[model samples]
Target: MLKFENVSKVYEDGFKAVDSVDFEILEGELLVLIGPSGSGKSTTMKMINRMIPHTDGKILIDGEDITKLNAAELRRNIGYVIQQIGLFPHYTIEKNIAIVPELKGWDKKKIKARVSELMEMVGLDPKTYAHRFPKELSGGQQQRVGVARALASNPRVILMDEPFSALDPITKEQLQGELISLHQKLNKTIVFVTHDMDEALKLGDRIAIMKDGSLLQLDTPEKLLHEPAHGFVEDFIGKHRIMQNPDLMPVTDVMNDKPLTSLPKRSPERALSIMRKRQVNTLVIVDENDVLLGIMPAYDLIAKMKEITKIEEIMYPPEPFLSASATAKDAILVMDDAPHGIIPIVDENKKVIGVVTRGSLLSALSTLWIETEESE
Candidate 1:
């Protein structure tokens, strides 16, 4: 656990960048620090590893004071990624990832294995890119290398300072999805700094809102959206932002109850006909009780209609689905990882309650925009 007890940073010229900030981040939590420029979010995050020493109060990690620890040793164990990526221009990808392990005197074989594992973890093929210099890769790939390098030493905590702000929208979105997947798999303690509230809501386990160097509010995304404590908090987050983002609402609100479905016994030809009539690319295959069996794609059914006997034969397992009680935010986060474009919202008995599609979710989320446009 990490805690800030009355933490404040007063510059030499007597400017207070942080004022009596107090919050604790639980282990394995991803906490986001966000505010306008000069709000001191960056300074607060940097103080975690003593990159910026606090002028007043204490910062503790696992109940030990960070100020008491050696700054070099403290930073070595805590991974940090920045907007610029900060890869050494001349260093190869393998060498870059191996830096921390080498500093601790790991043998070449161990470092090599660790580097290879991290490379694959970040979705880079080690054999293809290990020897390439930082300049050889695109902005996104270099950022991936930076992430791998940060994780090379197996740090329990990571600090990301606007890590994806430099990438193109497509790459940024893709990386955001990948980061969510990585967080779930690794469960690392992460402190991310970003000015984007939407990014904060999507990534943060909890968000810390700051203004004028003072911590205004710290709460979960749902709580922050629904219960903005201070007037500044509400204004900074935008009062109407919640209405614009339906992912903060219940999954049922964003899902369609009447999704196209097919029985496992239904012939592929019959399923294809239904797909054509409905103008959908996929169908949920259900049993006699309306319980989810699997999903059938139009392309698969079309390819196997003559070769397959039943829709079930061409259906893929619905491993990634949501319970009816799940929040829309849960569906949004996992949507990118779902193999099928559609996610079945199921009841406790495994009966399909509704389905959340890309279209359904987008339409529900964009309702405010559509209304605004119509009003204009």
Candidate 2:
């Protein structure tokens, strides 16, 4: 656990970058520190590793006073990822990831194995990327290597300072998903700092909202959204909440309860009539209970109307279904793997509630974009 007690940072220039702040980061939790520029979010995080000395208060890592720990030794045990990536331009990917383990004096063979494992873990095959320089990879790939190097030592705690902020929106979302997956599998305690509230909401277990160097609130993302502690909290989250709405959108809002064209059995004539009458491209297959079984495209019907005997034989399961409450952003992310541009929304009983299509999500996103622009 990491504990901050009355932590305050006052620069030598007599500016109070951080007020007396207090918080405890539980083990295996991803805590996000977020606020506007110069809100002291970064200052609080930097103090933990003594990258910047605090003027007042103490920080304890696992109950040990960080002030007393050797700076070099403490940093080695804590993984750090920054927006700059900071990869050694001269070093190969293999050498970059192996830096810490080498310092720990692991044998060459062990280091090689560890580096290979890290490389593969970060989706970089050793044979392909291990020898490549930082400049050889794309921006996203370089960031991936940066993350791989950070985790090279398997540190229990990680500090991410807007690690994905530099990437394009699509790349940022991809990296965020990757990071979430990695965190789930690894269960590392991560303290992430970001100016983006949506990023914090999607990634953080708990979010700390700061303003003018003072922490306004620290709570779960859901709580932060539904129950803002003050006007400032409300304004900040409310403004950015829509960008993260795709992840929070409920499946019930988009699923089709009485699908215009649904199939119950293998009757080509009936299916053809429904498809032609409704002028729909796809038909949902359901059992007697109205449970979604699969979907059959109208094109498939045109080709196999006479050949196929049963809907089950021709129908293929939809890519994947999501809960109504899931944000559209998450659905879109899932759609990256499924270019179909539609996601089935299921209820608690696993019954189809509605369908959120690319068009529907985009419509909702457009409103958010307009509203956000107006607010700014």
Candidate 3:
């Protein structure tokens, strides 16, 4: 919904903060702008709400030039949140959250309802905390109040400038999760600025990597991980790295879809034949609808060959399996110190679709390291 067209911001002293950066912020998408401290991510974000005016190029929202609109009116339509959690200490939480709505000339009843609703939405109990001053709340709580204040007018676009940077690690993580959940529910176009690559990968729909006031790369987290655009991009990613957060990497991204399988109703002889043909030690047992039942190890099948007829008789319950949406880090956690070398990937109906092996995980990691080294 927001578009930056060859936007550049050069100070009178001739230092360029942003240099001809162009990108579109899709509706309902969280677009994260990440880079080093001097990379102009914050400056790019400020240009959106006209907090910092651009020297050149046009910023359009739904095709209308933002420069043409009054600065206050433009800001009113776009919610802004900063790292400092700037809430007026003297103002009660309710009053802080109601600032925008009150300015828009909302009635007392409507403003009160909005304040209470927003407080509850951000996980603060309106009845208990609404009348409290900002000084009474913790840092995280104050940040939530800031977010509630930003959303007070129900703006279509939100610009968050390192909003979670000041909080402790645990609190930062909690707020990040809340922001992702809120994005999914509210579907507002968000332009987020962060120097932390991990935060960008975790939260962004598309991460824009910037350097020296220029756009370096912009892509989804998965693509960005697998294929960085330049040496600087690779080094930036390598420093923090995607492998460190495998939980953010989807199982589907690194799965063997054509895993060996057998039906539960199949005879032990048939199951053995399938395993031998596939050169696998174990066979995944599934029903006619491909729903995963369990697994049959070669030794288990061999020991019960004479006594058992159906594969189900010798099949042991499958160890923990992952959904298609599960992450590699999740698989690692499930497989840690476990006997199973592979984890079955299932769908919503428990149908076996793929398998991710420890070997695959190692290979993925090795490949990343190799790429990072090559980039250096």
In model 2, which runs have C-alpha deviations exceeding 4 angstroms? Answer: 239-376
RMSD to the hidden true structure, all candidates: 9.1, 7.6, 4.8
Writing each residue's lDDT as its tens digit, candidate 3 over 169-257 gives 99999999999999999999899999888899889999999999999999988778768888999878874366567766777767788
Local accuracy by lDDT, each model: 0.90, 0.83, 0.88
Report the alpha-carbon TM-score of model 1 versus the true structure: 0.71
- TM-scores, one per candidate: 0.71, 0.69, 0.79
263-348: candidate 1 lDDT, tens digit per residue: 89988777888889989998998998999999888877777778889878768998679997777788889899877788999999
Best first by lDDT, ranked: 1, 3, 2
Better of 1 and 2 by lDDT: 1
> How big is the positional error of residue 40 in model 2, measured in Å on the Cα after superposition?
0.7
Clashes of 1: 0
The positional error of residue 275 in candidate 2, measured at the CA in angstroms, is 34
Q: Candidate 3: where is the Cα deviation over 4 Å?
A: 250-279, 283-297, 300-326, 330-354, 358-376
- Model 3's number of clashes is 0
The TM-score between candidate 3 and the true structure equals 0.79
